[model samples]
Target: METIGLIAGNGRFPVLFARAARARGLRVVAVAHRGETEPDLEREADSVTWVRVGQVGRVIRALKAGGVSRAVMAGGVNKVRSMFSLRPDWRAMRLLGRAAGRGDDALLRAVSAELESEGIEIVPSTVFLQDIVVERGHLAGPPLSEREAADVRLGCRVLAALGPLDIGQCVVVERGVVLAIEAVEGTDRTIERGGSLGTGRAVVIKAAKTGQDMRFDVPAVGPRTIETMVRSGAGVLAVQAGATIMLEGERLIEMAARQGITVVGCDEHGNVGQS
Candidate 1:
């Protein structure tokens, strides 16, 4: 059987990826980060190896031992924890020391190169799960209103700028005014913060970073995203087409429709339409 290595991090994304890979007859071997990946993944994966947050050497060795020549990174690791709680092994420490400034792209690309040196190819996480990728079109309920559409357009521009800077993937806007930009606190918190700052009716846009390494940290959303929007009184969600991952697609759409929220996917060129 063919085996695919998974560097699993927090959230349901990693679990869902493992399930999808297994359904396609791929044996899933996961190197789950300590305190981040869900414990239930051990039951889902063919084999599970636990490693610290910054243990690059152990991750490589584990994949190599499993005879894995290709791997996908799924989900996100909270950077705050990495800064405050990391206990890197010697190899990881060396990589960190050599890093110029320890930015997300810098560190991940460096790790990818190290894995390549060990004959492991880092493949995009969307490889076998194209169905979950957001297509360019309207999703959920009705199309955005003129005002919401304008906000969507503005949100896209702001998010695009933030992407290249590795700032965050989400921005909330209303009537062409920027409400909040997601930072290390993440999407949900950003929504809540923006919602609190506004008088309701905000548009939230989530997109992948410019030149994002798809092997890791693909933008993801699901039912909870709608709940956040509802609580925050945000009326629209615009995600990047063919880039963002929508977990539990049917249910997510159902929930969004029930809440009367607009969900659209925008292309790389900022073309916003239904999925």
Candidate 2:
């Protein structure tokens, strides 16, 4: 069986990816972050290694030794926490020192380039999970109200503006009023914070960077996102169609329907799917 490398971060994405790969007869060699990755990863992977947050050289060595020529990054590492928690190894330190800025794209590009230098290609995170990638449509609950659709349009504008700044991919809006924008705190927290501020019937929008690099840090949404939105009293969840990974999408849609949450996958122009 061909062995693929999994550089896992926090969340079920890694676990799901490993399971999917194994189901298709691939052996997975996973290098999980010490505290960020779930412990259940070992059970899904053929082989697993643990590494600290900033152990770049160690990761390279481990993947190389396992004969992993290609790899994908799954899940997320909390950016704000990682800033304070990182213990950079010599290689990571050198890369960071020469990096243009500390933005997510810059740092990931540097890491990907370094990995390529060592003959390890970084593949798109969605490589094995295309079936779950969201398509353009109203996926659950009721179709968004006209007001909600407008809110999604405004949120897309907000995200488009934020993208160039590398600020975030999500925005919360209600009746064209922006509630909260996601920063390092992440999507779920952003939804909660924004939902708390709105009068009612808030909409959450998540989209890809205008020039998103799929090799790392791709958009990931699953059951937890739906649950958070339900608790936050957010009524609509819209993601960038074809660019977002809607993990466990059926369950997400079912849960959202039960909670009266509207879920959609749309393009940047906010064309709601045909009924």
TM per candidate comes to 0.96, 0.97
Off by over 4 Å in 1: none
Q: Residue 95 of candidate 2: its Cα lDDT?
A: 94
The sequence of per-residue lDDT tens digits that candidate 2 reaches over residues 1-275 is 79899999999999999999998899999999987899999999988999999999999999999999999998889787889999999999999987797888888889888999999999997888889888998899887899999999999988998888777889999988999999899999999999988865799999988787888767978999988887887889999988899988889989999988899988986667754
lDDT of candidate model 1 versus the reference: 0.87
Which candidate achieves the best TM-score against the true structure?
2
Q: Write the per-residue lDDT of candidate 1 for residues 178-274, one digit (tens) a residue.
A: 9999889989999988877777678888888888878878999999999999998888888888889999889999999998888888886457753
Identify the candidate with maximal lDDT: 2
**Residue 153 in model 1: lDDT:** 78
Checking candidate 1 for backbone clashes, the offending pairs are 137-273, 137-274, 137-275, 138-273, 138-274, 138-275
Runs with alpha carbons beyond 4 Å of true place in candidate 2? none
Lowest lDDT sum, 10 consecutive residues, model 2, at: 266-275
Looking at model 2, the pairs that clash are: none
